[model samples]
Target chain A: MSEAVLSIRNLTVEIPTRGGILRPVDQINYDINRGEILGIVGESGAGKSMAGNAVIGLLNRPAKITGGEIWLNGTRIDQLEGEDMRRLRGKHIGMVFQDPLTSLNPLLRIGDQLTETMLEHLDISRDKARKRAAAALDEVGIPAAAQRLDSYPHEFSGGMRQRVVIALALCAEPSLIIADEPTTALDVSVQAQIIALLKRLCRDRGTAVMLITHDMGVIAETADRVAVMYAGRLAELGNVRDVVTHPEHPYTDGLMGSTPLASKGLKRLRQISGSMPRLTAMPEGCAFHPRCEFAQDICRAEPRPKLNGGRSACHFPIQQPAEETA
Target chain B: MAMIQVKNLTRIFDVSKPWLNRVIERLPKAMLTAVSDVSFDVEERTVYSLVGESGSGKSTIGKMAVGLLKPTDGSVLINDIDLSRETDGGKLDKARSDIQMIFQDPYASLNPRWRVREIINEPVSARGGNVVGLAEKLLEQVGLSSLDADKFPHEFSGGQRQRICIARALASEPKLIVCDEPTSALDVSVQAQVLNLMSDLQENLGLTYLFISHDLTVVQHISDKIGVLYLGRLVEEATPDELFENPKHPYSQMLLAAAPKMDGFGREIDPPQGEIPDPINPPTGCAFHPRCPIATAKCSAERPEMRVVRGARVACHLAE
Candidate 1:
C-alpha cells in the first residue's frame, strides 16, 4: 500500500486500577491509506473505540495509551504535547461519533459548529467559512442547507443531524475521518442512504475513512479493508472481502454466520454461543477461548493473541475458504 | 379461529393547534391519522409482523392492540373480545393481562433504578398472579442468570436488557405478546439470541405474537405472516414466504428491495423512493402512490381496498 495517512503501530491502552494496570487494548497495528476505508469490527468493549480515541487524542481519562506510536503522515502523534495534538486535530484529523445529538452542543446552531472548525483550522474569514458551511451541508445531502444552517440539533431529524455532523467533519477537509458507528442510530432505510452518502463522499474526495462499527453489512458495502477486534486485541486484519467473506478467526467467522443476510432465506441464523466476557479480568490465553468451538488446551495458556499469521493471536485459525465461510 | 382480529382499526391523534388558535388562524383541526382502516388477524401461536417506516403507524397499531391507546373507529378483537374506548375497567384489565407489549427502547421501557427482579415481578405482584420461582425461572427462560435479576438495568448489555424485557413480558403469562421492535436496539449477535429466545418461548408457552418492526430481514425470520403498513393503513398482508417471494404491491416490493440483503450480491433494483407522506394530511386515494414508481393516475384518485391476490391481501389498483 502507498504511504498511509494514519499509521498505528504497536498501540496498546491500559486502564490503571487499585490492583494493577488492566490492559484494555493490546498491541495492534494498522494503517489507513490516503483514500482507503479501513473498518474496525468487534463486539462492544472490543477496544475498537479505544484504538480510535488513542489515535484522535481523545481517549477519556483513566484510560491511558501506555505504549504505542501513532504516525500521522510520518509525524509521531502519540508523543505530541497537548497543544500540538490540539492544533493537529481539525486540520489533519476529523472525528464523527456514533451519537450525533451528543457530539454537537445542543445550544449552538448548525452553522456555528461548521464555521468554528473552518475558522480554527483554515485561517479564513467568517463569511468565507459561512459560505463553505452551506456547501458542506449540501455535500452531505442535507436539504435546504442555507436555511438549515441556523437550526439547532433539536430542530433537525435523526438522519439530518448525522448529515450535519458529517458536514462539520468534512468542512475542515481533514485527511483522515474516524467515524464510530455513524449510522447505527439511524433506521435501516435511512441507514442505507447515510452509508451511501458517506461512502460516496469519501470516495470522490479521496479522503481516508476509519469506519468503526459492529455491523458487518456496513463493512461489506463501505470499507475497503476490515480489522476485527476482540477484548482489546486485533483478531484479524485483511482486505474487506478477505476478512468479511474469508475470515480466519473463529470469532469473525461466528459473527458472519450469525448475521441474517437477505440472500439467506428460511435457514436459521447462527449465533456466537456466549456473551462477551467482562473486560475487568480477561482470560489468560485467547480471550475468545471460552466461546470458540475448536479451542484446545494450548489455546488457553497465552495472555494475548498474535498480530500476524494472517489472523491475530490464534494458535489454530479456522481454515475455511472464502466461499466456505459463513 | 384467529387469536387477534383487527377490522378497520384507526387512531387519529389530535396533534392540531389548540382549539382557540385554530379558530383565529382560520385553519381546521390538524389531526394526524396515524393508523387508517388497518385490518388483519393474527393466528393463534403464530408470529404476525407489521413492517413499515416511522410515522407509518406500526407502533400506533401495536399500542391499540394492547389497549394502551383508544382506536378512533373500528375494532381490535383479541380472541373475539372487541377492545375499544368503551371497554370498561374489568374487561380492559383482563385484555391487558392477556396481551403484554415489549417496547422499542429497552432502556425506556424498563426502570433503570429498579432491580431486574422487581421489574419483572411488578406485573406478577400487581395482577396477584401465581408465578412461583419467578425471578430465577424468568432469567433462565430468557437465557440470563438468576444473578442478573438482582442487578440493575445498567449492568446488562443492550441484548441482555432486552432479554430482561422479554422476561418481564413473560411474567404475566400472557397469551399474546406485542413485540414492538424487540431486537431493533440490539447488536446482530445479541439480536439472534433474543429472536431465538422469543421463538423458543412461543413454542414452550404456546404464545401468539403481534411483532412490529421496520426491518424486513428480521421480520422474515421471526414472522409467520407479514403486513406492510403505509400511513397507518395495511398495504399488504401475507405469509412470510409469499410476501418476500412474490410481493404484489409496488410499495411492498420497494420496501423488500430497500432493506440491505447480506446475500443479494447487490443486484440493481430501484429502492422505494420518496419520503413518507405526512400522516396529518395523507395523499388522496393510496397514501403510498406518491412514493410508488409504478403508480398510475388511477392510484392517485382511487384507494384500492386490500384484497386476496395470490393468497395475500394487497391494496394496489395495479395489482388488481
Candidate 2:
C-alpha cells in the first residue's frame, strides 16, 4: 500500500476566550494516502475548517494547537513555526480556499502569479516557470491559456478565475492539497467542472487532498473517505460509501437525512431540530445530544465518547460494523 | 386566475463605459439584456421556481416580479393589476401590499440597529396600519418566541434570522412572496428547517411563491413548476417530476447532470463544454448555442420559441 501523505493524530485546537478555552478542534485522528481525498464534513462552527487551518498553520492568534501531532510525508510538523512553516506551505501543502477573488491578488496577472509561486517553491529558471505556468493553465482547461496569461484577475469570469486558482494551487506541485469549500461560491456547472478538475489533477499527480465542506453531495462524488465532525469532534470516519450509505453517528445520519436528494421526490426533509450548540454553552455530555433523537441518560451524563477502534464516537451507533452484526 | 402574471418581461441595463472612456476606447454602447422577453405565471398558493446559473437573470426576474425594479419593457401583474401601468393610486397600493419580497442574505437584509419588533412591524407601520403586537404574533407564527420580538437581530443564529425575515415578509400578509435564493446561504440542516417552514407557511397562508435559486435539489423539492433559465431566456418549464425525470432542453439536461448528487458515487460526467456566455453580448440566435453540445446551423442562425415537447415546454429545436 502507498504510504500516508498526511497523518493527523489526536489533534486539538483551542481558542482562549474570556468565557473559557473553546476547543474548536477536539482530539481527532485521520490519515490521507497518496492520491486519496478525505472529506471533512460538518456544519458551521463544527471545526472542519479549523482542523484544516490547524494543519496549514494558518490558525489566527487566540487559537492555537494545544495538543497532538501533524505528520506530512513522515515529518513531524506540528511544532514548526514562522519561517519554516511559511516555507513548507507552498512547497509541500497547497491550499484552495472558498473564494477565488480573495485567494488571488487582484493586481497581478494570472501568469505572473503562477510563475511566481512556481519560482518560489521550485528550482526552475524564470523562462521555464513562465512556460510551465501557461501549461498549468492549459491543463486546467483554461481557453487560450497563452493569451490569458497576460490578463489580470478581474478580467476572467468566476469559473475561469477558479480554474486559475486551481492552477496556482497546483503550479508548485505540492504533494497534498487542503481545499476548504472550494466549490461553495461557484455555480452548479462551474462547481462540477472545478470538482472534476481538482479530482483529475490530484489523481494524476497522486496528491493527497483534505476536502473540507458542508455539502454531502460534493463529498459523495469526490471523496474517497469521509470524516464527520460535530462540535469539534470526529463523530464518524469510514469509507465514503459505507459512511454515506449507513451513517453510524446520529449527527452524520441527521445531516444525510436533511440534505434534499434530487432522486427523492417531494418528501419533507428530515431536519435535525435545533441548531449546533455554541462553544460557550456546549451541552453536558455529547454536544449533539440536545438535537439527537436517540440521546439517553449516559449521553447527557458522560463526556463525549471517543472512537476507540470504532467507526463512530457514539455510545450506541445507528449501524453496527459487519463483524459485530455477524 | 394566476396570482402573479409576468408577460414578456424584458430588462436591459446600460453596461457601457463612461462617455469619455467609451470614446477613448472606441467602444460601442453595451447593453446587457438581463431578462429577455420571459413570461411565466404563478397560480395562487403554488410555488413556481426559476433555476439557473449566475448571470442567467433569475434574481433580476425576482426583483422585477416584486416591483423592486421596473422592466425596460413588458409588465408584471400582481392579482390582475399591472404594477407598473396601473395609475390608480389606491388600487396600485392594494396590489403592492399583497406582494412582498424575501432577500437571500438574512444578515444583510435586516437593519442592524432596529429591534426585531420594529423590523417585523415596519411593513405594517409604514402604511399606518395597526402595528401593535403584530411583531409578536408573527414571531410566534414563524416558530420564534414572542419575547424574541424585543431582541436584536445579532442575538439570533442564521437560521433564526431567516425565520425573522420570513416573519417580516408575512407581516403585511402578502399573497405573493418572491424569495430569491432564500436558503442558499444556510447550512443543510438549517436549510431544511427553513424550507419546511416556508412550505408550511405557504400551505397555511395560501401564499404564492416565485422562488429563485441556483440549487436544483432545493428547487425540485419545493417548486410545483420549474423554469430553466439560460442567458436570460426561459429555455424550459415543467413540473418537478417531469423536469427531473426527463429534461427536454439540453441546458436543463446539463444542469441536472452537473448538479452533485448524494447517490452519484464515482459517476463520471464530461465537464460541461463552456461557461455561460457574456450577457452583454450574447450569441445571436440561442444564447446557449455556443455552449450547447448538439448545436447545429439552425441553432445559431435562428432562435427556438417555447413549444410543448412531450409534457414539458422546451425551447430547443432538436427537442422532440
Candidate 3:
C-alpha cells in the first residue's frame, strides 16, 4: 500500500501489570494507501481496537506504545509532543468512536462541539466554523442541520447521533480516518448507510480509512484489504476477497465459519471453542493456539516468525511463503 | 392450531411533552408508537423470529408475547388464553408459565449480587413447584457446569452470563421462550455458542421460540419462519428459506439489501431510499411508502391489507 497515507512499523503496545509488562499489541507493520479502506477484523478483545487506539495515540492509561514508527503522511506521529499531536488529530487524522454518546459532549450544543474542534485545529473564525459545522452535518445526511446544530446529543436518536459524530470527525477533512467499531452500536440499516457514507466520502475526498471492527461482512463490503488480528497479533493480511474467501490463518477461517450469514439458513454454525486467553499472560508461541483447531506443538513452543518485517501474520505466514515460492 | 398468536399488537408511549408542559407551552400532545398493528402466529414447538432494524418493534413483539408488556391494542393469546390480568388466575398462570422471557443484556438482566443458584431459583420458587436440584440441573442443561451455580454473574464472561439467563428462563419449564436479542450483547465467537445452545435446547426440550432481533443473518441461522416488522407493523412473514430467497415485500427487500452481505465481495445492494417513517404519525397509508423503491401512488392513499403473495404474507400495494 505504498503511496501510503499512514505507515505503521514494528508497532508494539504493553500494559503495566503486577506480574510484568503485558503485551496487548505485539510488533506489527502495515500501511494504508491514500483514500483506501483498510479493514481490521477479529473477535472482541483481539487487540484489533488496541491497534487503532495506538495509531490515534488514544491508548488508555497503564498502556504504553513501547516501540514503533507511526508515519502519518510523511510526519512521524508516534513521537510528536502533546500540542503537536493535538493539532494534528482533528486537522489531519479524524476518528469515529464506537459509542457516539461517550465520544460526544452530552451537555454541549452540537454546533459548539463541532466548532470547538475547528477552533482548536483551524485558524477559521467562529462564524465560518459554525457554518462549516452545519454543512458537515448536512454532508453526513443529518436533516435540518442548521436547527439541529443547537441541540444536545441526547436530543437526537441513536442513528442521528452517530451521524453527528461522523460529521464532527469529517469537518476537519482529515487525511486519515480511524473508525473503531463505528457501526457496531447502530442498527443494521443505519449501519449500512453509515458504511456507505464513509466509503463514498473517502472516495470523493481521497481520504484513507482504517476500519476497526469484528464484523467480517462490513470488511468484505467496504474494505479494499483486510488485516485480521488474533490475541494481540496480526494473524493474516491480504486483499479483502482473498483473505475472507480463502483465509490463511486458522483464526480468520474460524471467524468466517462462525458468523451467521443472510443467505445461509437453519444450519449450525462452526463455533470456535474456548475463550481467548487474558492479555496479561498470552500463550508463549502463538497466542491463537489455544483455540486453533489446526494447532501443533510448534505453535506453542516459540514466537511465530515475523514476516511483514514486524507484522505477526501467524507462526507460519501464509501468503508470504507462497509468494516467495512463486 | 398455533401455540401463540398476536393480533393487531400496538404499544404507544406518552413520549410527548407532559400535559402540564404542553398546556404551558401551548403545544400539541404527541405519542410515540413503538409498535402498531403488528400481527403474527407461532407454530407449536417451532422457532418464529421477528427481525428488523433498531426501533422497528421486534423487541416489543417479543415482550408482548411473554406478557412482559401489555398491548395497547388487540390481544396476545397463549394456549388460547388472553394475556391479561383480568383473566382467571389458573389461565393467567398457565399463559405466563408457558412463555418465559430472556432479555438482551445478560449482564444487566442477571442479578450481579446474587449467586447463580438464587438467580435460577427465583422463577421456580415463584411458581411454588419444585424441581429437585433444579439449579444444578439448569446449569447443566445450559451447557454450564453444576459448580457454576455458586458463582456470581460477574465472574462469568458475556456468553456464560447469557447461558445462565437461558438456564434461568428454562428453569420455569416454559413451553415457549421469548429471546429478545439474546446474543447481540455477546462477541461473535460467543454468539455462535449461545445460538447453538438455544437450538439444541429447543430440540431436546421441545421448547418453542419467539426470537426477536435486528440481525437478519443470525435469525436466518435459527429461525424456521421469519416476520419482518417496520415501524411496529408486521410488513411481511414467510418461512426463513422462502422469505430470504424470494422476499416479496418492499420493506423486506429494503431490509435484505441493507443487510451487509456475507459473500466474499460485491457492490452493496442499493439500500431503501429513505429514513424510517415516524411511528406515531406514520405516513397516511403505508408507513414504508416514503422509502419503498417500488412505491405506487395507491400505496400512499390506501392501507394495503396483508395478503398472501406467492406464498408469503405481505403488506404492500404492489404485492399480489
Rank by DockQ, descending? 2, 3, 1
CA RMSD of each candidate after superposition: 3.0, 1.6, 2.7
Instruction: Estimate the TM-score for candidate 2.
Output: 0.98
A205-309 per-residue lDDT for model 1 (tens digits) = 889999999887778777888899988888888877767666788988888877766226644678887788777767888989999998989888864558664
TM-score of predicted chain A against the true chain A, for each candidate: 0.93, 0.96, 0.91
- Which residue pairs does candidate 2 place in steric collision? none
Q: Backbone collision count in every prediction?
A: 4, 0, 0
What DockQ was computed for model 3? 0.61
Q: What shift in Å separates residue A225 of candidate 3 from its native position after superposition?
A: 1.1
lDDT of 1 by residue, B206-227 (tens): 9999999887878888889999
| Each prediction's TM-score versus the true structure | 0.91, 0.98, 0.94
Lowest lDDT block of 10, candidate 2 chain B: B264-273
Top candidate when judged by DockQ against the true structure: 2
Cα distance off (Å), candidate 1, residue B304? 2.9
Give the per-residue lDDT digits (tens) of candidate 3, residues A157-222: 877888898888888889999999999988777788888889888999999999999887888999
> Which portions of model 1 show Cα errors greater than 4 Å?
A105-109, A144-155, A322-326, B17-28, B85-93, B111-118, B145-156, B263-273
- Which DockQ value does candidate 1 get? 0.42
Runs of candidate 2 with Cα error greater than 4 angstroms are: A320-326
**lDDT per residue (tens digit) for residues A110-210 in model 2:** 88899999888899999999999989999999889999999999998888888899899888989999999999999999999999999999889999999
Candidate achieving the largest lDDT: 2
Candidate 3: regions farther than 4 A off: A125-131, A143-155, A262-266, A309-312, A315-326, B264-269
